[model samples]
Target: MSADNRIIRVIKGRRPKVVVIGGGTGLPVIVKSLHEQNADVTAIVTVADDGGSSGIIRDYINVVPPGDIRNVLAALSDLPSLYLDIFQYRFNSKDAFFAGHAIGNLIIAALSEMKGGIFDAVQQLSQMLKVDGHVYPASNTPLTLNAEFTDGTTLSGEAEITGAGKHIQRVFVTESDLNAKEPPQAVNQVIDAIMNADVVVLGPGSLFTSILPNLMISNLGDAVKATKAEIIYIVNIMTQKGETEHFTDADHVRVLNRHLGEDFVDTVLVNIAPVPSDYLDHQKYDEYLVPVEHDYQGLRDLGCRVISADFLQLRNHGVFHDGDKVATEILNLAFQVGTMKKRRY
Candidate 1:
């Protein structure tokens, strides 16, 4: 049966604690659907974003970028739709001073200052926004994403790395400070979430920039490796430019495994549907390259239980994962594995 057609239901009085790790546009959709399914959700977002409004805000405020966290907060929030619309509203380019800044980003930046850190600021905002579940920054501090290209050149910052237009060897992150070489540390609460979760999910975001930055953190990656929870990866439906261009689904899994130094992903959800020819608007959806190719044998070689499904949703000429279908499948996996899978740390 297709994942969407699967008639899975959660038992009463039982909430499967699910921890989602990643950043960028795709993270919120999954979180919202899981929240609707009554799963206890915790989002661990990457802090390495340095582009557009987020980069501008990060430059001036010296706080962890709030864009990803803001989106996740809105997604899992129980607030009225009108309230969230106001929070998500953005200034037009004509308004040069505040152009492109979401009201929610400004609020998060303010709270970060008042709360003495982005982590605490998010906690405060989560309560105020009536967020349905926990939202933790991958690390309490700002992290700079750096990439080494195939030609042996290095670029720092998300924009530069992607804009370099070269094949990537690998990507890593570090504290934005000039003197720091160590990976930014994830907060203890994030580690606790992974260890206590019944399942941990990665991706449907930029494999290197959006997803890997979180896992690149030493403590967080270590916790993910050690956790007893089922490790699931929701592979992106389309390849991203400058990273994962022409990357097969198996190549995506391989990069993730190489970074963490283990075949840590227990399961992978791959989209089997096809995008129509020339369906994407290059001007509007410039970041996407093409549909990701499949390699079931390679995934099996990596020891992943590959779950293929028609999880594609096309809107505004852009491709996105069908959140409801993906969520149902994940909850089914959680139930299949049973709730007793949480590590006894």
Candidate 2:
């Protein structure tokens, strides 16, 4: 059904529909928390990844990079810890052929080949994993991330763009081939989820590579702009190198607005908790530069109702958004929107 005619059936006392869009370590944390909270969650993950296990799998076989999807599945899966551990298990260096590949990636790759598409593969796997929520790849095919540096030089591939450590002007998605000028399109379900959702979320991931690439698709970007759903941006807790160094919370919102060609962000989640000097282990978390600065006035100028709190969690010396805290805030926003919608009737 077309978005215009599609019916959103809200059963009495049913969970609010929350669609989370992004890729990276943070995405799963928020999704898992939402699942536990009984929200009708849908995760739209990036397929532009070209690093580590995902990169290797995408290179060997023309399949969507499965690293982010694998993580998301594990997070929402209701399986036993031991079963998940086996799926997440990696091969030792002694196993040359399969070394460093996570078992889940292989399974996803195999399923992708069998199903003839990553989207279908993920759906089939979701059923077997007993996932509580839906997980959708932003694109059906592997996508290459292309970035333009502030100096006007352009680069292709997530690894190259990020490894260069240059200030990025913007990043967009394209077909995996470098020669392709057109971007791979997001599937209908992704658009439907965004339009039909009670609340739509973007990032706590890399602003350029992880979140923006998904929004770059023409149809997907258009749907996001047109969706009446309350769009919430979960800003990163820390600035990332080669992406948003020295960026404030407002800068993140500004970039998002610029990418989508308008200010669509209704709510902005900012972490006000301070990171102690030298708190992060640089060797372990090299990509993180510093805690993202707060610019309350700037966020206000963008017409976003800012929710600043101690959404910070420290684990293994790495700073992260407290999943439960963030999820609670998201649910509150969703409920508030729902309440307002009902009162307007």
Worst 10 residues of 2 by lDDT: 1-10
lDDT of 1 at 299: 97
Candidate 2 off by > 4 Å: 1-12, 177-182, 340-345
Candidate 1 structure lDDT: 0.89
lDDT against the true structure, per candidate, is 0.89, 0.88
RMSD of each: 3.5, 5.2
Best by lDDT: 1
lDDT by residue for model 2 over 88-154, one digit each (tens)?
9998876767899999999999999999999999999999998878999999888888989889999
Clashes of 2: 0
How well does each candidate superpose onto the true structure, as a TM-score? 0.94, 0.93
Name the best candidate (by TM-score).
1
